[model samples]
Each structure stands twice: as structure tokens, then as C-alpha cells.
Target: MDFTRLSSVLTVVGALMLPFAPASAATLTFEDLNSGQASYDVVPSPYKGFAFSGWFYGPDTVYAPASGSIDLFTDYADPTDPGAYVITSNNAITSAVEFVFDGAAFSGYSGVTFELWDAGNLVATSDSLPDSQGAAPYGPTFLASGYSGLVDKVVVSGVQGYFSMDDFTYHAPASNNVPEPGSLALVLFGLGIGGLSARRRR
Candidate 1:
């Protein structure tokens, strides 16, 4: 075949492969934790496979010993006044609860999108937590992708002073394309022609 014809065929082949290359599918879900401090647990109902867990702390307070129960002192009290209601701990106070999941085991997803609702202001470890803090909720939302293997943990701190977490969730990509034998046969046929054309051009 002439070089011009060969180039035209190669361009067509490249166009065909474009759709199958890396594509981003962003999705999210939310699981509510009704007024409680608990370790991670699987989300119920529509989102059963995903799991989430976290704890709350007051200013200058240590986490409670119990796993799935809320501690009013550490979980509800205000970090500034101690006598008042503080959702997240003071910045000076470091320890906070962590929530994590095995992305591969649970949903076969590579990453997650996290959203937090704190009645008070929150200081996220990963991103700069939004500064505006009040009874009205405010937090950051972003994509987490590119995983070598299963994702073990995702930590969100500052549950004490003005920070609180209402809902945590995980999302899976929609398409799981595993080609059937017939589809593979078609691809192989195209590849064979492509190989012969490549050899002739050489």
C-alpha cells in the first residue's frame, strides 16, 4: 500500500481506540450518621456495600474508650468554652477519629469523593478546610483517584472545636467492560489486518 493510504488507515485505527482509553467517571454517595460517634460501619439500604466510621472530640479532649457510642464530653462539648457545644476540636489539639474502606473489596472503585457537614468550622488534613464555620454546614469536596491497590483509610480530623461530620460515602464507577469472546475475535481480526498493513508499509 502507498504511504498515504497506510497513514489514513492508521489514523482510523487511532480514532477507534480513543473511546476505550482512560476516561473519567465521577460519582458520589452519602451515608448519614444520626447523632452518634462510632467506628466505620457499612452504609445501609441503597448503599449497602460501602462502610464509614468516625469519632467526635471537644477542645483539648481525648477520644472516648468506647467504639460505637457517642461521648458527650469528648463528642459534643465545645472546644473553646468547654462548657458550650463545640463540634470540632481546637487546632492545637491533634487527635481525631479516622474513617477508611477497602476500595477494591467493597465496590471495585479506584478512588472516592468525600463530603463532610460540620455545624462548626473544620480543618481537614488533606485539603485546606473551608474557613467559614457556623451552625450551617461547610466543608470541601474533591476527587481521589489513581490507586495502586486497595485504599485502606481516609482520615478527616478536627471533629472537636467547630467541626462535625454528618455523612460519609463511597462511589463506584458505572461501567465494567469485559469484552466477550466475539468482541475479542473482531478485535483480533482488525489487529491482523493492521499488522499486515504495518509490515507492507515497512
Candidate 2:
């Protein structure tokens, strides 16, 4: 093959291999509990190629004397089971929750999984299995597609008394399948080729 043709083939092959490169793994942990200012933020667009999204809950504040606890549930509508799992004011909530990927960045994750620790015990878990209350009704819902840029805020509602948010976290996919560089690199390389061809013709 001529130098020009060989160069073209190598460039194409390199472009294709770029997409299969390993992805970076990023984890965001929410461990600060500030009164009225309790939240976690994650920019999945940066590392949208993650393979897993997880959240963990630890013990509660022993000093803060509160009446009610926080319940961990997905963003869904189900008046019947308002508080899925109760995290009392005295104990810790620890659980490895998993989420589903929809093919997009973090925007694709629409489910929330975690254990609700009530009074220091694993009271309930949010998963695909059926709950004692019967079939699982509402699931962890994400904001509308248009609102993907905004961080999806989840708050524990319907508390009998008062409580505080200690920690939260979110994980993202880290694989070549999610954000493949093949498409992006190919486009850029194609643009380069187009420009070169145009200049040669001129």
C-alpha cells in the first residue's frame, strides 16, 4: 500500500481502538451533616462511562436528640408506603445500594437501592425483591430528561418529628460501553481528514 493509504488505515484502526480504552472510576461520598444544608452533588457528565452507581449510609448522630428518623426511598409516588425504611435518631444506616443504567450518563440511572437502618438494625432494603407490604410500588425516579443537568435531590419526607441528613453518595459507570471514544474520536478524525482533502484539492 502507498504511504497515504497506509496512513489512512492506521488512523482508522487507532480511532476504533480509542473507544475501547478503559474508563476512569469516580466515587462521591456525602458524609457531612449540616442543619438545613444536607445534600450531595455529582457531575456524571464528566465520568458518564461508569459501570456502577452506589450509595452508603452510616450511623446517626448520637448527640443530636431528635424525635423522628430519616427513611431511604427512591423518588416515586406511593402514598401507601410513605416511609419505606426508618433510620432512627440513635443508630447508623449502612447499606450498599445499586442502581440501574439506562445507556446515557448518570441520566440513565432511575433506581435507588439501600438499607434503612431503624434503631440500629437492618429494618428493610430497597431492591427488586417483593416487600412485606406486597409488590414494590414506586421506584427511585430521576428528574425529567430536560432536568438532567441539575443534580437530583432526594429528601426524606413525612417524618413524625425531626431529623438530620448525615451522609449520601452516588456512583457512576466506568466502562467502554457507556461513553465510547470511538464516536467522538472518529468525528474529530473525520474532520481532520476532510480539512486535509479540501486543502489538497485547492
Candidate 3:
């Protein structure tokens, strides 16, 4: 009947009833692609995390602005271009997409832009690609995260020339995996034992 003891018991009960949280976000780097799929030679048919409507996948060093062998490249050329690229994720709710890009990969290259859409509704967009003018052969890296709302598709577009995007990283919604029935039972049992012990001590 003690107020403090009752408060403690209620807190314990609330904690015990909390559901187990599990990771729900996933990332795709395209490293799983084989040699036949490198250098933008062929699109990764039915790639996981997101579906590709129009895009090129390759290890073209000329596009990726990072050091070492550019293993993968996501080219977002002119919207009018036949090979324009669009990515969509249907398996899970997408949250963010972070990738490296080189706006000046080729001549007439002005800048780049990207957009996030959920169920055909535009949710987020990168209006102007940052003008880093990367040094030497590589361009600058950019990380875009903390997107609001759920995203299902992403579209990358360039101004004049083609924009080279590499290391496409997409984030899915965070979810706490539900604990196994046995695990939950054990946890509940432990909490009950602790609660009984506390009551006896009082």
C-alpha cells in the first residue's frame, strides 16, 4: 500500500511489458554484383532494397570520384537520355539515401539533384548538388540522411551532363525484432521473480 513501492512496481510492470526492439534498416552497396554487372554494362536486374527502372551499374573509374579502383557507379544522366535512372524500394519503407557523386565527370556537367518519393508522392529532394569541384580525378563525397517520413523511390538527375553516383546507400525503417516466445517468457519470469523479491524485502 506504500505509495513509493506501488510506483516502483508500476514502473517495473511497464518495463516488463515493453516489446523487444530490432533493427529494421538495411543498406545496399552493389558490391554483390558480379563482373558481368560491373562498369554499367548491364543493370542489376531486380536488385534488392530498391528496384531500378532506368540506371547503369559499372565500375567506371571515370565516373566515381573516389580513390582506388571505382568498383561501382550509378550514373544519373539527363532526364531525356534513354538510360536515365530511377530507384524504388517496395520491400520496406525507405528512410534515406547517401551516395558519393561527381557532377563534373564529363563536359557540360552543371550539377545534380535527387528526390525521394513515397507512393508517387514527392517527399524529399536535393535541389542543387553541392559544388565541391573535387580535386584531381575524384569529386567530393556527400552524405544525405535524416529524411522525414517514409520514402519508397529515389530519382537522381543532372543539369547538363551526366552525374556519376557511387556507393549508393539506402536506409530502411528502424524496427525492433520481436523476441522469441521462449525468450519473452524467460524475461517475464525473471521480472516477476525480481518483483516478488522487492515486495518481500519491503
The residue-by-residue lDDT of candidate 1 on 1-202, one tens digit each, is: 4677567766776776665554342222222333343443333322234223433322212322122222212133333564543333221211132223211101100122222322233322333344334533332223232232223344433334343332233333222464566995698688668768778778
RMSD of candidate 3 to true structure, Å = 9.6
- Per-residue CA lDDT of model 3 for 134-192, tens digit only, reads 44333545545336455666665543224444455543343345567899778768866
For all candidates in order, the CA lDDT equals: 0.35, 0.31, 0.48
In terms of lDDT, model 3 sits at 0.48
Whole-model lDDT, model 2: 0.31
Q: 1 or 2: which has the higher TM-score? A: 1
My TM-score estimates for the predictions, one after another, are 0.32, 0.23, 0.53
Per-residue error for 5 in candidate 3, Å, reads 14
TM-score, cand. 2 vs. native:
0.23
Best by TM-score: 3
**Quick one: best lDDT, which candidate?**
3
For model 1, the run of ten residues with the poorest summed lDDT: 102-111
Which of 2 and 3 is the better model by lDDT? Answer: 3
Question: What digit string (tens of lDDT, one per residue) describes model 2 on residues 57-103?
Answer: 22222112121222222122223444633322222222233222111
